[model samples]
Target: MGWRRSRSSEPHADLRLLIERFGWAVEHVRVPRRSTGTPSSYTVGLTAAGHPEIVVLGLPAPVAQDFLNAVAEQVRAGGSYRPGQRTGEFTDEDGPVVFLRVEDTGGLASARDVYGSVEALQLVWPDSTGRLPWQPGYRNAPGVQPLLGQVP
Candidate 1:
């Protein structure tokens, strides 16, 4: 059976089905370039499956969704990530992706709203030159990738 819809009119029925079948669901958020924030995506229901929810910042909505899905798939397959861990499993033209522990969940309101007080990680990808945002020669603008946690 489907869960009751929330006041915000989110697709609880669809999300429920997804979580039941896939162990989690990805929520892609697309923010306009002119907006104060950049595009991001996060996972829902991962905590229930014994894994921390995941988030990726500064990517296009589709790419972010795909990345989150890949991470979720790996998690379901028994792969795990920790803060400051770097893995080549998910990579761009530049290099491996890094995982950062989300010390603050304020930016993940949607994921929190779905699963209260869930632990989360941010998947940080490198720039064209394989430089992370904190490293020199990083390509993206400062606002493009707002880190939700401290750089490890």
Candidate 2:
């Protein structure tokens, strides 16, 4: 009954969905032209409200293009991260965006999973000593379904 996603149709679909649901002011920065050869990598940026930029670097041309598309989609959808939500905020304005970093892992296999079992949930604050925080388990609402799984 709530926002359940079947499997994602393409690579990075889930990431794009996350960005679409949670980012503000997403953009693609073009690589400078090189006379002798074409640029091999691209950069994509996403900024949530009250947070610094989250940059994805060294993306392949196709993926970079997809990032651009994701930006457009986010804009059209008017998506934004809400303040006070666990996964939404950074430790500070300059704190890390805590991306899934698709390039580091292989890719998103299904809509339900990220890098095996790592689902991007609300971000909890670090301990008093300043250690990095990790993602918490996600729960579906009573009348809502996750995009990946069926409700019983």
Candidate 3:
């Protein structure tokens, strides 16, 4: 069970469990924010009990604010693209935030099932206070779960 995570994301308790359970290789999970340009979406990968789950991680207060700011700029400028993927006048420091996507064999539905077990695992954050850092995901988003029924 091994996977990757982005360096800049963060995760909550339940999310952490799903990450560990699935053995995702990503460094972190990307949180969603209201984007003015293109419709913004986020996701995470999971593999619980040899299955995968795509639980959409929630946006933290600080992270969400940053994304919203970028969205505003894009809307006013008539731009399109996510803050992390876009640039020029309207861009967020947001890096390549890891997103849950469909795998070859399992697709994404299997990942969703893994998240369903998150509650039972009682996942814990790497930090004692459980407060995600500015870069986040590393301590929190690394284990965050994605919403899989549909990438809302």
Best model per TM-score: 1
Q: Which of the two, 2 or 3, has more TM-score?
A: 3
Model 1 CA lDDT for position 9: 54
Write down the RMSD of candidate 2 (Cα, Å): 17.8
Q: What is every candidate's alpha-carbon RMSD to the true fold?
A: 4.0, 17.8, 17.3
Judged by whole-model lDDT over C-alpha atoms, candidate 1 comes out at: 0.79
Cα lDDT tens digits for candidate 1, 21-96: 7788777776776788778788887888788899888887677777888888889888888899988877856478
Per-candidate TM-score against the hidden true structure: 0.87, 0.23, 0.25
Q: Output the lDDT of residue 97, model 1.
A: 84
| Model 3 C-alpha lDDT per residue in residues 1-63, reported as the tens digit of each score | 222323335434454554555433222233345542212222233232232222223445344
lDDT, candidate 1, at 126: 89
Cα displacement (Å) at residue 78, model 1:
0.6
**TM-score, prediction 3:** 0.25
**CA lDDT, candidate 2, residue 66:** 49
Summing lDDT over every window of 10 consecutive residues in candidate 3, give the lowest-scoring window: 118-127
TM-score of 1: 0.87
**Backbone clash pairs in model 2 (N, Cα, C under 3 Å; residues 3+ apart or in different chains), count:** 11
Candidate 1 Cα errors over 4 Å, as ranges: 1-10, 92-94
